[model samples]
Target: MRIATWNVNSVRQRLDHLLGYLGAVAPDVLCLQELKCTDDSFPRQEIEAAGYHCNVHGQKGFNGVAILSRRPVEATAGLPGEPEDTQARFIEARVPDGGGEILVASIYLPNGNPVGTDKYPYKLRFMDRLAAHARQRLAEGATLVLAGDYNVIPDRRDAADPEAWVHDALFLPETRERYRTLVSLGLTDALRATTDHAGVYSFWDYQAGAWQRNKGIRIDHLLLSSRAADRLVDVTIDKDMRAAEKPSDHVPVRIDLR
Candidate 1:
């Protein structure tokens, strides 16, 4: 199975670029974040016509997520479970086939920019909720895969310039610790499992000529449970996608498994 994750920034703005990549790479399952559209605005017909079934959880303007799969996707629950925090940031789905049932989650974690602000606290709180949810999923004995723009950098090896990000929200010690706590529950960083090298990035700043200079951050990721990671074959970041016309600030990170 091939699963891919990308933060499209705004699905409507990058729909063309997305369609082109979908045709070329053709992952069995594609998880998207930052759709930046209301549920009604999601282009369902266009996506369905491309031979994939989509399960979308979206709100207006910012922070949306969706899962697209070649097989039937049974809509599951959204994360955190707080009725007041319904910003469409999480969605789970099950793809049932003869082999078994595959559980996939698409997430858009809080960006948490400008540390020492409300957003930063929300990011930490959100991480706690995510950790709890992951623990529940692990207990269910499901072949689980969680993919998305995590918005938190796990370590110095995952960042372009570690010094520059010292005080940034993504690299803050507390935030990183929360991420570590969650993954400690038997989830593997599928990309890091294949290589130990640094300077591999998935996102670049549009305002800073970061892409041209190759100054980027590896924020997006595919973290899988042991049940799924055992079958991992390959992991790749489509850096080329970042150069596409009207491309997203982020690009796709793909994992191929048995």
Candidate 2:
């Protein structure tokens, strides 16, 4: 099966780009983040016509996530251990794969900008909650794929100019340490597992000719549980998507599993 993740930025704003991608790439499962619309307002009809079943956990204007699968899915909304957190940032689905099933999550982890504010702490708390949930699920021996825009630059190699992000929330030492803690739980970062090559990125800012200069970062990810990782075949970053008209700053990261 082929699974892909993309932070479309805003589903409505990039509907055309999305439809084109669906038709061309046709992943078996697609996880989406930053939908920026309520569930009822999701463009369900258009997506359904493109041959995917939608499971959306959405908020009005800020954070939202969804899972789109070619096959039907049983979905769960919200991250466990955070009942008070109302942001629509996490959604999971159990998607059928051959005779078995794999758990897939669409996550839009908090950006946590302006490090001194409450947002940074909230982001760390959210990471803790996610790690706990993932640990539990892995202990249950589930085949899992946690795919989305993690809003993290896991390593210096992940960014074009690492020094430029030294003071940024996404690249702060604490942030990367927490990310390492999560990975230490035995999740395989699909891309790094495939290649150690630097300068491969999944996002480029739309400002200052960033894309033109190839100043990009590999923030979007698909981290796989051992069971799923055992079957991993390939990982691809669809960088061309960033060049499309009205493009999202992010591109799709896809993985193939046998």
Give the number of the best model, judged by lDDT.
2
Task: Tell me the lDDT of model 1 at 116.
Answer: 70
Tell me the lDDT of model 2 at 220. 95
Q: Write one digit per residue (lDDT tens) for candidate 1, span 165-228.
A: 9999999999899999989999999989999999999999997788998888999988899978
Model 1 ranges with Cα > 4 A deviation: none
Residue pair clashes in candidate 2:
none
Tens digits of per-residue lDDT for model 2 on 1-258?
999999999999999999999999999999999999999999999999999999999999879999999988999999988778999999999999879999999999999998999999999999999999999999999999999999999998999999989999999999999999999999999999989989999999988999999999989999999999999999989989998988999999999999
What's the residue-level lDDT of 222 in candidate 1? Answer: 87
Instruction: Estimate the overall C-alpha local distance difference test score of candidate 1.
Output: 0.89
lDDT of each: 0.89, 0.94
> For each candidate, C-alpha RMSD in Å?
1.1, 0.6
RMSD of 1: 1.1
TM-score of each: 0.97, 0.99
lDDT at 202 for candidate 2?
94
